[model samples]
Each structure stands twice: as structure tokens, then as C-alpha cells.
Target chain A: MICIKNFLTILVTFFLILSCVLTAQEGKALQEDSKNSLISGSRSLQFRISNNLTLTSFEGAMISAKKHFTSNSALRFGLGLDIRSGQEDYGAVEEDDNLFELELIAQYIYYTSPKAPVNLYLGTGPQFTYNRHVQDRNYEETGEDAAWQYDRSWTIGLLATFGVEWFAIENISFFCEYGASIGYQSRYMESTPYQGYQDQETTQFRLSSQTVDFGLSVYF
Target chain B: MSRLKKSVIAALLLVFGILTGTISGQNDMQTTQDQQPGPQLEHTWSFQAGISEYFTLRNFDMVSLSVKRHFSNKSALRLGTWINFWARETSQSEIKNWDGTNADTEIENRYYFAALSLQYITYLSSGKDVKCYLGIGPRIRFEYWKTTYESKSDALTRLGGDSGEIFAGLQSNLGAEYFFTDNISLIAEYGAILDFWGYSDLYNYKNELSSGFRFSLSPLPVNFGVSIYF
Candidate 1:
């Protein structure tokens, strides 16, 4: 819910700024030859930041690229990964932990104003994410039992995105996007200490933006 | 066909139709300008000093200093450095045994980190006062941390250790600079990092070694800084 609120706040702020810009130029014709206009065959590399600002911590970053099929349409693909592992040992206790995560996104984007300095776009894509964590604990004391645990989860979904892009300078643009998703998720957990385990799967329909994506793209 | 299937097909067709219309219209509007922006800043040097996570209003965990030499309007070389130092102290009193006698414990932790990065930056586009650049480079980092615990009442309860790490990695930075003036600009950058780290721990005069790699796919711009050019 907090994520949704932050995304809405940013959305409102963007529209307010957009309205002001429009109001200031209400009577004048916008320059037709924008220095940052898109054309067919254009390609771009982008670094996207996913954050729920002031609500949650910084989520992560994704590297993505886009290839324009036409002046108004494009295809984009993104990839992200994270890995961590650590170990600790004291006189009486020893433990080890590891984590791995991967995410991928592919989208088809249709720009509503490809020729304008500011482009409004609608995109739809399929996304996949997977993560796993494992831990092991051992006690040196007599009659103490060792514990092993692991948790794993994966999700695959389709996402629809609404976004706006502003060309701050020629060949470079800044964008903020919001997304909604419908997907299926599977989770499994096992712990040996108490013989506790869980396995669950479900379908998810989410409209609230889990992440607010802000990105900078350099067009080639 | 099912209603959902029909709808999906119709939507795809509509999108394709719009794409076709726009492509044809673009042919009449003249192709996009291929001309590059006129020469702006070249053969110049710049220096920047800033803090990371500036909005948190917390302790300065990460401080940065960097220098850049522009070879041309389209490219440059930059060397950046960052350092972090953090210390924490805690004192607590607790009951350790069935006799219910109070025991006092003091704990102190210190951490230090430093990194140096060398990058080659390419300007994708520069216009007037705003420009965007892509930088990719190698970085070297060192970290040291120590913790000490003292429990005067219970000798067996005291436990802490020290560790150190060295990291070598490649990082790619995507960022934009908004020039506030001809010589000063504001920068916001996000980095995609790949790191290989080696770790060592010292306990009871024994050393242990561990190694790992980390890769982050997407990230927010944690670095915001101001730069001055000469």
C-alpha cells in the first residue's frame, strides 16, 4: 500500500508539471523540429532504477535496451541479477547463508507522440523473476542438533506500463513509468530443525505499482 | 474464437495500424535531425565532491571526490574516489544466570571502506546546458571492520571478531548533468555493478578466507553531486 501511495504522489507531481508546461505554451505552436525526435531504426541503451521512494528501500537496477521498429513503436528487453553469501563461526556456533535472485522483462512499446519533445507511451510485457535463499546452522554443544533451511520462490507475469519520457538533451532522455501485472507465483520452504516445511502456489493480479521506475536512456 | 482471444487479436491489429500510420506520417515530416550539437566544452578539466544517499539526512556514510578531463565534446576520462567510516558503541545491563545478578556489557564496532574507480565516459548527446553520458570502468575497493565486546561480570559472554575484504569489479554508470551555469552542473547517476570480492577474518589468531561475486541488475541513482569545470 505504501508503494502505491508513493507511486501516486509521483504521478500527481508529474501531471502537475506537465499541466504547467502546457499552460505556459497554450497559444504557441510547439516546434516541429525537436532536437530529440525519434525515428525508425533508432536504438537505445537504458539504465532503469526501481524504487519506492520514502516508503521502501531502493529495490535494484535493471539494464535494458530498446530497438525502434518504427518512429512510434519499439521493443525493449531488461535483465537484473543479485547474489550474496556469507559465513560466521564463533566458539560454540557456526552458520552459513546464501541468496540468489534473477529478473527479466520484455516489452513492446507504442509511443503516442514520437515527434514531440515529450513522449507518452504504453507498453505491455512479460516478466519473470526467481529467487532462492539457503542457510545452515551448527551448534558445538553436546546433544545440540544442526539445522538446515531453504526458501525458494518464482513468479512469471504479464505487465502493462504507462510512462512519460522527456528529452533533457539530444540523444538522452529521462523517463518515469508505472506498471500493473497479472501473474502466477510459487513458493517453497523447508527447515530441518523442527521438520517444518511449506509449499504454496497462487495467481496474483496486482494493480498497485510495486516499483516506480525511473530511467535514463542514451539513444544511438 | 473466444471473446478474449478475439479482443486480443483486435488490439494487436489496432496497434499495428497506428504504427503504420505514424511511420508513413513521419516520412512526410522529414527524417529526424542527424546533425550533432555544436562544440560546447572540450579540452577542459572538472572536479566534483559530493555525498551518497544525500536525501537520507543521516550520517555521511559515503563521501566522494572525482576528477574528469574532457578530451573532446564527445568523450572524457574520469577517476573517482569514495570513502566511508562508521562507528557504533552500545552498553547494556542484563541478568545472565538464575541468581539474577546484573551483568554489564559494552560493545564497540568500527567499519572503514574506500574505493577508487577509473572510467571512460562517452557523451551520447549534448545540447545547450543539459547533457547525458555513459561511463563504464573498473573499480578497486577495500573494507575493514572490527567489533569488540567486554562483559566485566561474565568473561564467557564476551565475543566479537574482525574482518577485511578486497574487491575488484566493473561498473557502468548512466547519468545526466544539468548545467546550472557555464562552469557548474548538477549530476545524478545510477550504476550497474559487478564485483568479485575476497574476504579474510581473524579470530583466536586464526585466519579464514572466503570469496564471492555480486551482480546488480537495476538500481536507483544513489550518487548525486555537483561539478565545477575549468
Candidate 2:
């Protein structure tokens, strides 16, 4: 029964979004009489800080290229790099770790206005991410000799986002976004020669993330 | 001939209706073309950090620090990293025999396991706003164990060992994100680790009606974070 109800809710939501898009398109058509313009472009850059710095937080840089096909329609491509560091508290054991991420994104956007200072946009795209991390202490009892070591890995996945940007000042805007992505990662550790035994360990790990972010974008 | 033809036509119609109904139901749930404002390009990037808590049979507490990045618009890619810290407390006990003889035993065990992995992710539509991503890739795991035993006769022994192994497997993640604005969104994800290569190891046990250990160290991870797009 719960599944059925959820299914129905989803169906309704999809239709609602579709209708909104259609209506927005119609509105754009009606405004065509004013001035049908094409080929408008903009570039933007932004930075973000995570709220839970103890777990994860960083400063990142991004560059976006957008092409407007119609007054209110466009497509966008983005590239970004982030460097973050934080501590992991293992209840009884704790370690500080750092990570670096680089990504490339492509998306389709539907905008509410071409000339309006504030516009709403929704987009989804494919992202390729490369991630690497290092830890200070391996969480083991036998001191540094029996401690674990860390390594880096790279993976690919899909990402989606919806948000709005408000141009509070000319060529400058504040934007907020919500998005999620799913991907996989491989992680392993090597043990040094201990006593008379050679030790080895490895495991396959999964990676996924959901986030809400706010930042300032400078457009040129 | 006429009766047989009617029956055949009726069966065909029944099958067609069922198939169409299923397809329409799925389409209705997933079709979001209506939400698209116009033919526009939209790109969003996000990063999330969270802590994971693990519970094993022995009640050892492990802390995990994880980082994730996501891009959403068309096909998506996600990258994440996690480091885990494992710990435990010492136990002491005494037992009595039928003859009134008592035996004292103290056992102390401490260990930690650190794992890292990279995965390729794909999303299966759950609804307009909810989706599940299946991730497959390789993982590296390291385990270090230390044990101390004490007897009533003042005999003490200490032993410790460490092991490292790498395996390839499937990782599954399910989650949902709610968009409050076109650029800002909140998300939650739950992930499961599935091991295939590790199943054949000597320490692997299969109690869940399978060939290998029914359960090994399957990590259940959950994360929440915020995302922004440029």
C-alpha cells in the first residue's frame, strides 16, 4: 500500500513539472513578438564552504559556459575543483583526513527569463570525478607499525541539480542549489612486514553524495 | 472459426492493456519533461561530508569520515572517499564449577579497519524526485587486531596481527534530494557494500543460505549534504 501511494505521488509530481515546463514554453512563445533573440552567452565563477567542517569542508572554484538557444532556453557546461580537509572521530579513535576532487559537468537548463535580473534554472548532467585522500593515523592498537595506510582512486557517475540565481548587482549574483550524485570507489591499504608475517587487506567501497549549497557567482 | 478468432483477439487485447498499463505507470512516475522550463543548459555541482557509525557482533564502535561530489543534469558522476576507525573495550569475567572451583579470565581485544574505494554510478528512477544509484568498483581494506589474555594463575599472553586485501564488488546506494531553489538542494543517501571476491576467503562465512559467509563486513553508510550549481 505504501509503495502504491508513493508511486501515485511521483506520477502526479512528474506531470506537474511537465505542465509547468509547457506553460513556461508557451509564455516564452507569447513574448516572441517583443524581440526574438538568440546566441546570448554568460560565464560564471563560484566558491562554497561546508557547514560541518569537522566532517568535511573546503573552498572550490568553478567555471560555467552557457548558450541561450531562445530567450528563456539554454544549455550549460561546468568544470570545478575542490580541496577539503577535516577530522573523523571514531568514538574511541580519531584521525584527520584530506581529500581533493575534480569534476566536469554538462547540463540542460530551462530559464524563466533571458533579460530578467533574477531567473530560475533546472538542469541535469553527467560528471566525471577524480578523488584522492590521506589520513594521519591508521586506527590500530599496535602503534605505527601495525597501522593501516591510505591510497587514492577515481570513478564516474551521474549528477542532477535545480536552483535559482538572483542578480543582486550587475554582473554579480547569489545562487543556491540542491543536487545529488551516485558513484563507486575502490580503496585498499598495505601493511608493513610485521614480526614474521606478511599482511595484506583490501575492500571495494561505494560513493554517493547529496548536498545543498549557496554561493556567489561573478558573471562576465 | 468465428469463436476461436474472437478468443484470440480478446487475449491479445488483454496482454496489450497490461503492458501499456505498466509502461504508462512507469512513465507517469518518471516523466519530468513538464518540469523543464525551456530548452536550457543547467549544470550543478555538490560536495557532502558525513560521519558513519558501524556496529559488529562484538559491539565495537567504528567512526567513518566520508566525502562525496556530484554533478546533476543528464547522466551523473559521483566520487567519494571514507576512512574508518575501529575500537573496543576490555572484558573481564569469572566462572564457577560444580565442585565450587572458580576460574577467572580476562580478554582484551582492540582493532581498526580502514577502507577506501572508487565507484561508477547509475541512477534508476524511483519517482520525480527520488532515485537510486547502483555503484560498482574496487575497494581496499586493512585490518589490525591486538588481543591480550590473562588467567587466574598470573599467566599473560599478548598477540597482534594485521592484514590488507583488495576486492572488486558492487555498491548500491538509494537516496532522495529536495530542491528548494534552482541552485540549492538538500539530499540524503543510504549505501550498501556487496563483496564477491572476499566471499571466497578463508575467513568468509556464509550463514544466509549462500555459498560464502552469509555476512561479512558489509558497511551501511548514510550521508546528508547540500549542493550548488554554477
Candidate 3:
């Protein structure tokens, strides 16, 4: 029964291969560069937001604004927030996981040149995240809720990113960034009915990805 | 050569052939377009987020996002990520004993995976507002599966277990993108993959001795998404 699914996967593989071979002759011509293309240096300051047409992140929305502080340097500040209900169930237990996260970041960027449409940059900032989850479990024999637990944590991290952005049209552009974060986290967890109610606590230092974001910018 | 060796060689040859053909076609297209004026087609960066697995039973269970950059009119590269959420959870039911007496137990399960890949693409046909490309790449995947069982009388006494696996695969695909404007386009693609995974010491409720390896080939690795080129 399991191999059947595997077979389907294999079948899909062959199909893609065949399609690539057969269409080896279908495309038309080389795309040429336009003479009237939008140039990046034309704009001194810009505001950007998530171009997400779909649900891509935990944050409901992301907004950032950037301004040129010097001939080849700039500053940007960003904010991202998410508020949602979370749930965790452990058979006999059901729990509510409510999450409220706010990330604030400030970055300094250096552009290559005033007229260069392709700009390279490096940025660093801080990020903060918080989560609180509650869980409850019950017994079938008792037909009532009984044991429960709650876990909450806060994280503070430092981030660094290096990437580039290209202006493709009049007011819109795309950016790709790769970065990492190092941070400290503290968590508090408590379980009821644990030897008549005991609690556990944890603290740790961690490293994580600060990447990846593909965003759109509408320049003014 | 052994069958394994032959398969590897064939894969290499296949990839080489596609890349060579794409390069030659690019040269031909450039030469032809040099004589005439075409729409200024300078597209360097693009982002795409779309749905996949449209033809399978687990349709629309996968979502993907790719950040692509064109190095030339004919060649491009992309970094992509895929997230799958095909896990289903059933409500816990009371465990029954052979004697028709309630055993007072319940259980739940969840399974999912995440993947990342790097792709190199050559435009077979490129125009100001449209493009068709063929590409190949390597992908890495991490999969997790777990189940939980609880005694109705004690939540803390419940057992939660998990198994993890890592896979590496080579993938190839053919795709097209049509720009509605200079920035936004509708994109679609179908790819093929051969994924290999090996592991020993799998857990089955209690830790048991289990070992295996798998090399799976899947057809119709499909995707449809909106892309913004900048």
C-alpha cells in the first residue's frame, strides 16, 4: 500500500522529464533591454510593504520605510506584527495557544552608486518574539476536563543580512536577502496536577535564520 | 557499469544535454533578435508564490515561493522553498478492551515536511512579455511524523512519539511565465524528482528495530503561482 504512493511519485518524475524533452523547440526569442527602463538612483527615499497575494508569513502585514542619509548610505526601519489564537491538544488534553508577536528592526544600508540601478547592501537589527500557549486534557471515565499546562516564552535576537535590490519598473522593485540571528530566550512552563502542582522553567541561547524575505518596494 | 552506475550516468548525460541545448538556442535567439527591435525585456529579479500538486490526491497541499534572478536574457537562477501540510488529525476515541469494557485511551497523529532547492534555468524562448524555460536543480527535504496516545485518567502519562528523516533529490522541470504587466506575471511549472532517503532505528510506539532506504520517483511535480519581476 505504501509503495503505491511511491509509484505515483515516480510516475510524476517521468512525466516532468518527458515534458521538458518534447518542448525543447517551443520558445521564441531573446528578451532585449528597454532604453526607457526605470533607474534606481532616481528615487531618494522609499516606502515598501508586503506584496504577498497569499498567506506567506506569521505576520499579518509588514511595512518599512527607507531614506537616504548620505550620497551612498541610507537608514530603514521596519515593523511586523501578528496576533492569533493557538491550540495544542494532547489526547486527553486540549489547550489554547494565543500568540502576539511584534518585530521591530532598524538597518543601515550602503548603495553602490548614485545612478546604479542594482544596489548591494548589508543591514543589522534586533527582533523580538513572544508566544503563550495553554493546554488542557480530560479523562473519558470522568467525562470532564482535568489536567492542563501553560507555556510562554520571549526571544530577543540580533540579525544581519546582505543582499541586493533591482528596480525593474517605474516605481516597483524586488529584493532578496539572506541573514542569520543569534539570540537569548527564556521560557516559563507550568503543569497542573504535577505532584499536586509543580512548575518547570527554561532559559537558553540559540542561533536561527534571519532570512528569507522577498519583498516589493513602491518608490516615491 | 552496474545498474546504479548506469542510472547515475544517464542522469548526468540528460542534464548536460538540456543545458547545452538551451545555450545553443540562446545564441540562435540572440542572433535573430539582434536584427530587429523587440520589447525591452530586461527582467533581473522576480518573486513567485504558488500552489502545487494540482493533479494528485493531495492536491493543493503544497505551497511554494521562489526568488529568481536573471543573469542574462537567456539564463537565470532561483532559490526556492516548499512547505507541505497534508497532515490530518482525528479526534481521540475511547480504547475498548476485548471484554467490551472501556480501556480508557485515545490517540492522535500528524505528519509534514519542508524542502529547499537551488535551480539553474535557461530560457528556451524569451520575449518582452513572455518566457519559457527549462531547469534542473538539487533539493533537500526534512520530514517529521508523530503520534500521541493518552490514558483518559492521566494527561501527563500520555505518550507522544516522533520520527524524522532527511532526503536529497535531483529535480528537473519545464515552465513558463507570462507577464501581465512589467512587474506581475502568472507562472506555471511541472517537474520531476528522484528522491533518496535512508534510515535505521525507526520508532514504532515503542522503540523497535527497523531499518530501510528508499529511492522514489514522482511524476507531476506541478506548480501555479503569481510572480512579480523586478
Candidate 4:
């Protein structure tokens, strides 16, 4: 009975795959006639946002740009920096939380169909991220000493990306991408002002299909 | 054995039927579109939210959101995300048994999880107000959790260490969506995954890493959701 179940599962999965392939080819029908969209020496600016469907609030906003070497290929660079400070107060107690983050990414993108309105693309490059966070708590009437904690970390990695892009008009396009990464992280943490700091290092490998990134680009 | 053979034959026949039906359906749509020239309701942006099986099964513990942009009536790009964050802090006071003094304890815990998915979608068939489409994309996920404890008494004060894990992974999914109305639709999908996890003793700064790969299929139509187009 178990063998039969497994076979049935595989059979159904195969059918699904076949259906996808057949329907995927139908994408050509959606292409609109647009010319000269991808040209050499063209520079484009891209703005990216985390793929949050509700758009309740936006997080991880990144600005990047691309310079086309050829109609089929380009070099892209991105830089991001963010600082946050928050405080909480409860009568005689006060708490503060602060964070600082910076990231840099450089990648090479290759478009498989440069002339088509809908293009499939692949990108690979190096990425680095740094973060610093501090938290503090203070008591006024209780005569307790103020307590603070600090943490810092930096990550360097190589990332591979796959995505699809659609040009709505001659000068504007929207793209969606996913990435996999292998990297290293170094971290330092201090539990309290009096306690000594601890240093740690980690080697990381990740395949993150769940972090779908969405972005728009405009050519100048 | 006889039953197995019969099942295999049935599966093959079903596959044939589906394939032919899909091809003929596309043809029929084209012919209908050509015959009737009406206002095409094509919206470029859509938003969707629903429940998923990967995080938690009961009481809608996991919430998923998705947004799609249609390049044309036949093709589109979709991005979906699931993000959650929770934090708690507690304090307790009790009398020490031996010292007959007040003992105070404080505990803090925090957890976060997020997943993002992207796919290219193509419409295979369409009816008057319904469309059947296929979508495939990559998914990435991250999770983190940490907890710390502190205790103070008359004679001595002790601090408990912190422990947590930072996990990240990638996966690929293939799914299909059916639009029942001009503005509403439903989707179902499955995928293969590769995940990596890092365990840590935060106070001591000790870390360990592990990774694995697997295939996931959440019984058909279970990982389903609704979408609204604008």
C-alpha cells in the first residue's frame, strides 16, 4: 500500500510539471512590441522593497544602479544604510534601543532575451553587511544601576540570483528576484558594561527562495 | 499486483486527459477572444493574504502576503512574504526558603521568522471570468530566537546565559492559481528546499552550523489562499 501511494504521488507530481512547462511557453503571447530598451552604455537606477503583499509598511528599502556593458549584460551596485533609535519609559524605569546597519552589494546581470519585453535573467556577485545594536535600561527610584548590552556583527558573502523582468514601457521596468548565498560572519557581544566582550565567527551557507525581492528601474 | 497495474493505467489515462484538455482550452479561449471585442479588464497590481502550512497549522499562526504585477493578460510576476516577530519579558518575586529573603527573577525572550517568495506566472487557460495559470519561483527564509534570565537574592545575584539560533535557507516552488472572478482568485503550490541553521550560546559566543536538503509537498490544495486584483 505504501508503494502504491508513493507511485501515485510521483505520478501526480509529474503531471504538474508537464502542465507548467506547456503553459510557460505561452508567455510569448504577453510580450508587447518595444524596441531599443536595452542599449550599451545605458545607466539605470533601481529601487527595491521587501515583498510584503499588504504594503502595510515597507522594510529593507535598497537603492541600486546598473551600467550596461552590452545589450545582454550589465554590472550592478547597491548600497544601503539604516539607523534606528527607540525608547520606552515606565514611571521610574526607562529603556532605550538603538541599531545601525550598512550593506553593499555588487553583481553582474545577464539577460537571456534582451530584445523581448519579458526577460529572464541571472545575477551573481559579492555582498557585505554590518550591524551594530545597543540596548539600555535605567531605574531612577529603585537605586538600581543602569544596565546596557551591546552587539556588533559583520557578514561577507557571495550571492547567486535568478529573476524575471517586464518592461511596461520603453524606459520603465519592474523585476522580481530570489537569491542563494554562502558567507562568513564575525560577531562581538557584551552582555553588560562590566562583563568582557566575546568574539565569535561563523561560516554560513543559505538558499533563500523565500526572500523574494521586488524592484523597479528607470533608464536615463 | 493486479491492483497496482490497474492504478498505473488509470494514472496514465488521467494525465492524457489533462494534457489534451489544457491544449484545447487555450484554443477555445483564443477563438472566443477573437469573436468578441470588449473592454479587457487587465489590472497590473494585485495583493493576496492567506494561511500556510510550513510555519504553524493551528489557529492561523502563520500569515502569508503576496503581490502580483501582470505584464499582460497572459503573463505576470508575483512576490509573496511571511514575517513574524514576538518578544516577552517577565519578572517574579518569591521568598527564599533557606534565607527567608526576597528573591527576584527576570526573564526575556524574543523570536523572529520571515520568508519571501517570487515566481513568474503564465496563464494557460481562461473562461469568461476565470483564468488558470502556472507559477514557479524561489523562496528564502530566516529565523532567529533568543532568551535570557537573571535572578537576585539577599546573599547573591546570578545571571543566566542566553541561547538562540539563526537559520536561513532557499527553496523552489511550482504552483497553479485559478481566478474565479475578475477580482478574486486562489492558489496552491509545492517545492524543494535547502535549509541551513546556526545554533549559538549568546553569552559565551559559541556557534555551530548545520544544513540539509529536502522535498516538500503539502497535500494538494491545502496551501491555498485568496488574491484580490486592483
Give the per-residue lDDT digits (tens) of candidate 3, residues A1-72: 555655554456546765675565342211222121233332222222233232122111243456555646
Superposed by TM-score, candidate 4 places the C-alpha of residue A189 at a distance from the truth, in angstroms, of 2.7
DockQ of each two-chain model: 0.07, 0.02, 0.01, 0.02
Best by DockQ: 1
Candidate 4 docking classification: incorrect
| TM-score of predicted structure 3, chain A | 0.56
Candidate 1 local lDDT, A50-83, one digit each (tens): 3422111122344566889898999887766777
Worst 10 residues of 3 chain A by lDDT: A28-37
Ordered by DockQ, highest first, the candidates read 1, 4, 2, 3
Instruction: Estimate, for each residue in A1-220, the C-alpha lDDT of model 4 and write its tens digit.
Output: 7776968775886678686756675554444354545779776656443223211111122345678999899988865565555554544556667777788888999999898768889999888999888887778577574777888889888888888888765555778888788787777776664655434444455544437878665554
Worst 10 residues of 1 chain A by lDDT: A50-59
In candidate 2, stretches whose alpha carbon ends up further than 4 angstroms from where it belongs are A1-39, A49-101, A112-118, A132-150, A193-209, B1-230
TM-score of chain B of 3: 0.57
The residue ranges of model 3 lying beyond 4 angstroms of the native Cα positions read A1-80, A85-97, A137-145, A170-174, A193-197, A207-220, B1-230
Order of all candidates by lDDT, from best down to worst? 1, 4, 3, 2
| lDDT at residue A42 of model 1 (Cα atoms) | 71
TM-score of each: 0.61, 0.29, 0.35, 0.37
What lDDT does model 3 reach?
Answer: 0.59
